[model samples]
Target: MEPGAHISARDNVVKHDRTDFEVPLMEKDFAELLPRGKMPLANRLPVLNLFNQAVSLGGLKAAGAKLRQDVIGCNETKIVVVDHGTGLPRSCIAF
Candidate 1:
């Protein structure tokens, strides 16, 4: 990759408008989501399960999802909450 080289990416971009929202889940829906014996109980666990638990417990927004995307050669982690089909940033604590 050169600094001034011209490159084209047809459909290589994630076109997300402010109206993009993530799928929501609940705690009771966990069993249906995880495969039998597939749910890891090890360190850190899985973010998906934690997400479900949070919404069910009202710790996190019920219509939101966590996103960790790369931006400007850096990792931009944020919690995207659903705001009527729009993805809004609940909080973005960069380290």
Candidate 2:
């Protein structure tokens, strides 16, 4: 997608919903820099760590549910307690 395009989790794994940031280079700038060796310089733009929050939450919830189910299915009686105060919500941990 284009640099300023609106993106969502359903569109792809990368979430680009945020529009409050700026791109250091434009298409014209890139075209001009192609002749030089610095066209795709790594330092030209800031590094961003983007993730899909919805996909992450869904995976976590599924894992938690599977863990709870497996623990309950054990033949030996064991007390399984999950703490919900680390960072995730209580509902997520309770799954």
Top lDDT hit: 2
In TM-score terms, which candidate is top? 2
Local lDDT at 5 for model 1: 14
Show model 1 residue runs off by greater than 4 Å. 1-16, 26-28, 32-38, 42-95
Residue 37, model 2: Cα distance from true site in angstroms:
40
lDDT of 2 by residue, 19-94 (tens): 4455656545456546463556544533432343334445666766677776454322544342322321222222
At residue 95, give the lDDT of candidate 1. 60
Model 2, residue pairs in steric clash: none
What is the clash count of model 1? 0
Candidate 1 residue 22 Cα shift, in angstroms, is: 2.0
All candidates: TM-score: 0.17, 0.20
lDDT, model 1? 0.37
